[model samples]
Target: MDYRMFKHRMVNIVERMKAIGGNVSEVMIGAPASLQQIEACEIKLGFQIPESFKKVLLEFSSSCNLRWVFPDEYQLAGELDGIFSGMLHWDLALLKELNDDKNGWVKEVFSNPDDEYDKVWHQTLAFYEVGNGDYIAFDLVDNSTDACVIYLSHDDGEGHGYKLADNFIDFLEKWARIAFVGGEDWQWLLFTSNAQSGLLPDSQSAKLFRSLLKLSI
Candidate 1:
């Protein structure tokens, strides 16, 4: 999608997620980061970020600041996990220090070695970090136009996460549809593709969403 389309979709998701939960203190969308800043960040990370994801951040949020207007709170995980905000770091060298193998920080955090990382774990860079060591990330090595969005677990090496959506936008659309359930939510493991909450559909949180928001699911 074009920058305009990406921006529009992101705005809508931000609005929908915020409306779902009024936890403003938790969500933190930032100002736009300069192209130079984004380029430098990519160099530091040693991988090219997907354009679809890049367009959204470049047109919307800053490197480490909050957007204040939208998608600021999509974090929705432990303490509202920030996406692009956490994906990037203003400090260039910090990338290596953070993801280095010495700290046991797995560059390839996802478990399914063949399917997820494709054995090129070092090429993967996590953009969204769940406060508890998990992440919502994309693989740089993906040759597709829109990179695949994958989940990464800090603790679980065997079953960290698998390919969720084909692209970032699809991922956001799914999250928004489900009221942006908590990041790395237990319900996540329940879905093969789509995520539901209560047992009938998903969790109690999802049931509450259905009753209060009147969602069809």
Candidate 2:
């Protein structure tokens, strides 16, 4: 990653997020930009990233704010797709239990719980090798719709990729080789993980909404 380039991109993203009313903070990763690392990523991933995205990466990596939103999952790595393959957490079992029953306690927690507060969950998991990368996953509580995105970098300071799905069912069928699954059921499973991961807590979640409110005002 090119520190100079990455720095430039981050500035842009921060400014844009600010315009959209996003919380920002400082985050740290150990490394400077290197050409060798970038080339290696391309050989591994077999793809190229658009110039527009590279600009975004430079900004996100060179600065901070590792945790922007609660529901977004950020995955950083030193290799191509190897980040997702690392230390996999088997939360599927717990997820399955939470989603199996509609009237279950877990379902209620995500639904009209706590004086009927409406909740929506979203996740972004960013995976990177040189600088920290992020991947995102998320879902809606009321309707239970889920989505995910994987951000990868390549060509040192020039190439990058972002893989995203509109919802969990789309991700499973289109990306994961799973088919014919009902959207509602799969979203419940994904949303359970979002809640369990603490990506969307009642307080922080409320704060984000407040932030949104201020933006609109």
> Following a full C-alpha superposition, what root-mean-square deviation does model 1 have from the true structure?
8.2
> What's the CA error at residue 133 for candidate 2, in Å?
17
Clashes of each: 16, 33
The TM-scores, one per candidate, come to 0.57, 0.24
lDDT by residue (1-217, candidate 2, tens digit) is: 2445434444443443445444544434333324454445434434332232233333322212332221134322222111121111112112222223322322444344343221221212222222232112233222332233322222221112223344332332232111111121221122222322321212343234324323221
User: Could you give candidate 1's per-residue lDDT for residues 112-208 as a string of tens digits?
Assistant: 4565333434356565555566665665564565587766656553335466566665665455444444355343444333321211234454445
Where is model 2 more than 4 Å wrong at Cα? 1-26, 29-32, 58-65, 68-208, 211-217
In the order shown, the candidates' Cα RMSDs to the true structure are 8.2, 18.6
How many clashing residue pairs, candidate 2?
Answer: 33
Off by over 4 Å in 1: 1-26, 63-103, 107-122, 157-159, 191-217
What 10-residue stretch in candidate 1 is worst by lDDT?
A: 82-91
